[model samples]
Target: MSQRKVTMQVIADTVGVSKYVVSKTLNNKLGVSEATRQKILFTAKQLGYSKDGPSEGPSLPLETEIENGYILVVLPNYEYQSISYTYWGAVFQGISLHIQSKKAGMIVITSEMDLSKKVDVPNLIGIITVGTVDEQTLLALSTYNLPIVTLDHEARIIRADSIFMDNLGGIERMTDHLIGLGHKQLLFVGNIHYSQSFYERWIGFRNSLEKADIPLTQGNQKILTIPYDDNMEANLQQHFEELRIHSTDFPTAFVCANDHIARRMIVLLEQNGLACPTDISVTGFDSLEEDKHLSPALTTVQVLKQVMGRRAVDRLVWRAKNRDYPSEKILIVGDITFNESIDAPKKR
Candidate 1:
């Protein structure tokens, strides 16, 4: 039979596979083994079948599947708008660049509508979750048994592929810097139990205090918490006001978890008639460029979010390629930015 006359049935018959398998392999629906996928594609090509009709065979975009299968970035309900939120945009940027380089298809799952409320993606290569998820979410995901890589989440119970910022080292260095500046009395801001990174940062803060012989006093840690709710500004103000009342005798400086907290600390402190680095010094993690807009500019830990994101993609693709490979975890460290927000404490 002429190569032009050969159909999917011919290729499936020759490869000893079903017609449906051959069709999915060609159209890229995803459940078949990679070896089987390759075999079907090879057979189909040899028999001269292409998406654009048989002729000289398939091109780069369509040798067998749709851009080498689908990789989904899930964030529960948050949409990726900009990298302004503690360097999340950088993470997205890194994922996009790497996936494009690999010539792969990528989709982000934020809500139920993306896949018609069905999380079942037969051809899913892997998943990279970018935000915090509850046990229910994790449980639902476990049912699929898809290759997963979690970013910025620190629930210790689940074992999966993950990448994390060096929260401990970064926060430790920031705390140590405050201590060195003659700021003996300092506070740790942000809720320590908010996420895994938050807890690690708290560990670093306590470690630094202990090393310096300073105590982690009862009221020194102010946990400013705001869940996924609409009244964040009001809640944040309330948290700060509650802290300010008890913070008078607390510290000369504050070690904030991330830039967002540091920025708020500065504003709230000013409202309470205190000035950063003058009355009280403050340092933060996640050296966001947008933070330059802050009056004194934030002194923070510089994070390589894009690098972390790229590393995650590397792990995800590798795991997908090697289905039986054990899960891997990657840790990325950061540097400190000694900006105007940190300085020697004011004289008593």
Candidate 2:
């Protein structure tokens, strides 16, 4: 007895279906019921049909052509908010441009997805991440063994390439600018997360205050760890009132984490019958979109967001092509944009 050769028609006949149905089922295409699809697949396998063959399995190439390479871009947040859009837009543009120049493509992903669930995507040559990732997530990315480049967040200590803005320098510049305007009692407002950027900014704020011989007293500093959302206005207002009550004297200035916070603080101050630059001067980091349009244009440190984007892509691609490349920390400096929000401290 000789073994009968197995074919789609044979499988269809065995499963009591048309050859077209078996073909569609094997190709994993639409139109086949789940039960029918499973029956067709099981029968074909039992009959000694090679499931790994091109006709039976997925048709993706074993290795994507080098000329048509693809990379993955990851962002920290799911939605566009704050200055994230600006940074994301510039970084994505840089990655897309670079990929297009090399006749390749990029697939952008957000870390907002629950990592416990599985994701389906092609093998990526490299990754460009925009924010700090937790250790578990970092381990998962390391499992891929692909070169990653981070922007705005520190990537040096981790097993990845990085391009970050000189956040400490920017904060220092902003604080110094306030000091120059005769702001002795300055308040630094920001979250105290260990993420590199935030940590650096906090360090800069402390160092600037210490250099000026100003004590880091509770009355002169506040750290808000709460989420900025619908109730943010109320929360901030309450926090501000508490600060005012505690302080022996009102701080002459406030250095905020970013422009959004500064804007909110301004509004809250006005509501409480306090005015900026007259009652207290204010400065912000990450020159945001609405900064210039505010009643008093914000004085802020403009991070080289677009430049950071381009550098991140260039470095990631370079590392992807050559694995032995030494990782580097590229820090772009930001400049202060002076505006009406800052002025000499008011007379006591």
Candidate 3:
């Protein structure tokens, strides 16, 4: 007679551990200690254990018997008090929609919302982080060893998948749009070194100019040293200072990294008696509707925050099912929104 199949249960029986622990260890999921995982793996190898499941991937534990299905969602450090109904809010809505469909629970927290605060996460099957997070947070999460996915974050490790907007492509499209409007002497605002996304956007800006045979002068790239890590007012002051420093020789238009910065530049320019698209044209990325300060609508890239969130959740779900696959970096594209913020440069 043929030998009996080597199941996870047989390995568990040999290791004096639960079948669930062996399954978790094999799938690289949570709820298994490192030592136990190693022991189970060693024993399974020794026993020549071959999975009875389909070749596509390992089958998940029966849903009826295992009730532990919870996904932890981490957002960048930002207040959700007023932001709950805006861009981030839409993203959360998308995430919740997916989790609800999957019959799973979720625990949402921000970096600033729970720094050094330990909360109970009993059944964490996966983690999804939105936006760029600090290195400390990334280091802390790397220990979980569970499937993690990110949206709009460029700082992700080997275990995490990143789903973000095509910052470089969107920026290039916006820049070309400005050039089509007959504007030159363009300035790319915001500190490019702050984040990987920003650096890519700056590159797009430079590339667009080169493609159009336009010179990107040294003074055109304004590197504003802002305190974006924590303080808002300080960051605003610094951005204004960088713009003010070149007030005498202001470019015809400015392409900001994001909408928030672009809105602030418009306000500061107006305060100094320069009107947007009249004296200076300004374009931005991530067209959020919550900023009521933008009277003259920003000609920017419209990134679908909710779509990005949904895609990230989908990737996380895929990762949860397939443990052996390499991490993926999916780029979501944005559309250019034509608005009153940019126009042809006025006659000299």
Candidate 4:
């Protein structure tokens, strides 16, 4: 049986654009926008269009090609945000190991680097971004029109598949755990505006409080909305000092946004002559490596960091096969690890 031939007209019709636009896009001409060009190319690939005729095989960006070609991993260019950090390091390891297992090449570049100037476009099959990437950087990556999958982040200006942990659920669970310990007065500690994940964690905290019939007071809101900056540490200390002066208003426990913040809070509490799980209980998210060796382990949510990176690779491969499909946001669920940090509130 003979199959119908795929043509530029077919792709143009699928993409709702003029045949002239499709022609220009396929030839890599200058008229069309990067987004439009990518759409046209994806549509053409989906329809099996080629210079020779409708191809029996998938397009250039396919599983086979992805295995043979290199995948580029983009990370934020911050001193503390690199792969050396506990969370990001695990994620990068997952990505590196998965790529190695697939016999595929992988190149990592920081967002600080100019994509067009640094990247060898022809040899690359796809891109996987680890953390927050600015719109300008995203736009630069878009010029290549490759399939992009982001881990623990999303792009505001471009279309890409996103993979994130169950931020809301994890925190909500942790908060519920704290509430179960009879800690009625709980304070959330984190700059809610720090990142999307952090903001969601704050929401989760509020959700749990609401569920427990706890009022969302202005005092609680103030702690969650701390300004993120160099002075934040000082501000946090000042808040602690005030809490000490007004012991009646102090929370029974501190629910921090992440492990680092939780650890910092514990230190500050000790400095203020308060003891963790005695005077005040504490909880943290992101069950990091350091939690194992600490005198009193941190109670935190176990984010599947490596799984995020590995699944990102899996998603890129999926994208390669289904370029014409709608973008997807993938969420991986994580479990909470109860440790020495959380306890019943001491009677005043």
Q: In lDDT terms, which candidate is top?
A: 4
TM-score of 3: 0.71
Mind sharing the TM-score for model 2? 0.72
Instruction: Tell me which residue pairs clash in candidate 1.
Output: 83-89
Clashing pairs counted in every model:
1, 0, 0, 0
Better of 1 and 2 by TM-score: 2
RMSD of 2: 17.3
User: Tens-digit lDDT track for model 3 on 1-348?
Assistant: 656677889889999999888889999899887878878887776676766632232334333211347888887754431346576778777887777777788788777664455446776787888777887887677667778887777554446888878999999988888889897768787777777778889989888999998865564553344434446445665655655634555578889888877888788778767788888898888888776355898888998977877787778777877665557789988999888889898765
lDDT of 1 by residue, 114-204 (tens): 3424565667777787867666666566556666788877545555787898899889888887888787877777666667888899889
Q: List the candidate 2 regions with Cα displacement exceeding 4 Å.
A: 1-67, 77-87, 112-123, 155-158, 217-227, 245-248
Candidate 2 lDDT, tens digit per residue, 1-348? 655567888888899999999999989899999989878877776665654432433222243343566777776764422345665565566656666777767776667666555345565677778777666666666666788887766554468877877888889878876787788877776665635777788788878878878777665453454344577678877766766633457677888877777888888888888888778787888887646777788898887666676687677767766554347788889888989888998887
| Highest-TM-score candidate | 4
Residue-level lDDT tens digits of model 4 in 284-306: 88888876798578889999888
The candidate with the higher lDDT, 3 or 4, is 4
Question: Candidate 1 — which residues are off by over 4 angstroms?
Answer: 1-67, 81-86, 111-122, 155-158, 217-250, 322-325
Superposed by TM-score, candidate 3 places the C-alpha of residue 252 at a distance from the truth, in angstroms, of 0.5
lDDT of each: 0.74, 0.72, 0.75, 0.83
- In candidate 4, the residue pairs with backbone N, CA or C atoms under 3 Å apart (3 or more residues apart, or in different chains) clash, namely none
Residue 344 in model 1: lDDT: 91
Against the true structure, candidate 4 reaches a TM-score of 0.79
